[model samples]
Target: MQERGALLEVVVLHPRDVPGADEGGADRLFLVNDIESGGLSPEPGTVSRLCRETEIPVRVMLRLNDGLTTTGGELSRLVGLAEDYLSVGAEGLAFGFLDSDLEIDVEVCGYLADRLPGVPWTFHRAIDSALETDRAWRQVRHLPGVDAVLSAGSVRGLDAGCDELVERAAADPEVARLLMAGGGLRGEHVPWLARAGVRQFHVGSTVRPGGSWTKAYVDAAHVRSWRMLVDDAVDHELARRTTPYT
Candidate 1:
């Protein structure tokens, strides 16, 4: 079982990975398709089957094409797709939007949030690619139903962005609370992130055997190792919080 107060989310590209992820202690599954395109939306039938099979909460991706901008008939199509995913039992959604200027496209995001009133969502890595980091964070903080903001602090992922993530979390309480640290996440990053107050973690190819999204399946043992690493890190952070100063 995963430790309380921390979440370990694993990506599921196919239904076959479901049992191993669930059995290996994933708290939730980020269901997506076409990993090569950085994860576009999955078909509703796929979502339905995975939702039916896995007890873990499933957050389906809502992007139709590569990049963050959506407009015209594409927006309409996405709204309908959102409904389809919900109808099939998706517990949450993962999406992000940016204008041509590379800023948070609040209008588009708000429109979708309005249509799906109570559904929780995550603002994905588009925040890292925004024109300004602080401005994007400010915009997303108030968006309705956005329970988390997935970021690696830079577009380049953890190796380049880890320090920035730690600093941001320490400086801003809301960022810390809503931040779901991910993108090239590794075991060493877990302890630092946990200590900095990140309670949620997302893993993609990391949980797969040989870390190959196409060649290898998600391995139960690999997932379990991540579960243990995150759980232990969170446990230690909690202990440190309650420990008396010398």
Candidate 2:
């Protein structure tokens, strides 16, 4: 990854959205077959197809099911899926699991990290479920293989918690290394989020046409609009950062 302030354009794409995302100029892709349950592991063929089809990088979700917490068996399955995804040429992996007390399951996450040291890893929003989020996020930030955090701050969603997330990022340059702002982001939110030190923005259901609530389909135009909005936001943020203060 680049330094704390570099822009990373990432979009969560269902298998159905590949063509649209590709045509619409996405910089990278987070491929998930099951978007309704937050996100989950995708089919091996799906990963392979995306890797084969898209020149941009691809990352796959590793959660076997929806809930943030996982059993030992379920974690193993996640590991298995991670391995499968990497084998099929996924550029990175995104996932997280918590223990009963809702803290980062260090043992589990560490094991996954150790299992795939060469590839990049992102601790997903499941970190929001951490019982004491501040401590949990701090703990995970120091882990050996964690690269980025897909977070909406500590609260349930981005709108309410983004300022807190910005505070956390400003407090810790390490967290800023890959602090990706996501969760219910629309085009208008990009400029503000960019100003708050969010270097990456993750868009999911809203990127579809007909809107996420109306069972929107994959429309390249939707992705194109998002691309334009995000680019404008990043450019403005960069200019603001470099401007001389009189």
Candidate 3:
């Protein structure tokens, strides 16, 4: 099981946004490019700079395109990019794959994991888009180096997936430990998820002014508020769990 304190991971599109996220108590930074395309792999130089400069862990995205399926040629490029990110000291990676049948692509995922041995990675939100949720979860459970799975419990994001997330976490201990509740996550969702035993959370545009991904940058105060909110919720949940029933 994950440790008791809740973790706040923030998405960073550019180097400038790094300070606010780090200073705001973000536990990690999900580095990606082109947020409008659901996040593509960022330039290696950017990863190098951020990883070199920041104390916080940065998990670089390992996707070349918008879709989950990768071509052989794209896979080669991705492997090369993964090497570059690792050479620059990226703490970890965020990636996922799907077959044409819309199922989790274990072969592809395992291949990449083999090439990037010992690197901790996240199975990104592709699980929410899989044809069968149970099958998807089963496929990812044993994948090497996958320490976390980012999901909203649905492709449409938290408003549509919050109940499922809470229920699934409550039902499965492993799910609760590995799930990083995110994607359209809001302040209101934190307590419910915490009570359900989810210890990690992700935020993107929500930490930006007006929740705008393109117009504004992540504000430290906004990220700090989320940090405080998640910490408080987790503390309450921990207290409730430990207190003897009267």
Model 3 misplaced stretches (Cα beyond 4 Å): none
lDDT of candidate 1 over 85-155, digit per residue (tens): 99988999999999999999999999999999999999989999999999999999999999999999988
Model 2 misplacement above 4 A: 1-14, 213-215
lDDT per residue, candidate 3, 1-246, as tens digits?
435799999999878888889879999999999888889999999998888768899999999989989999999999999999989988999999999999999999999999999999999999999999998998998999998999999989999999999999999989998999999999899999999999999999989999888888889999999999999999999988888988
Can you list the residue pairs that collide in candidate 1? none
Lowest summed-lDDT stretch of 10 residues in model 1? 1-10
Per-prediction TM-score to the true structure, in the order listed: 0.97, 0.89, 0.97
Model with the higher lDDT, candidate 2 or 3: 3
The C-alpha lDDT values of all candidates are 0.91, 0.76, 0.93
lDDT tens string, model 2, 128-234? 77889778877788766777888887546877777787777777766766688887666666776677666787777676765662376556787788777877777
* Separate clash counts for every candidate: 0, 0, 0
For candidate 1, report its TM-score: 0.97
Ranking of predictions according to lDDT: 3, 1, 2
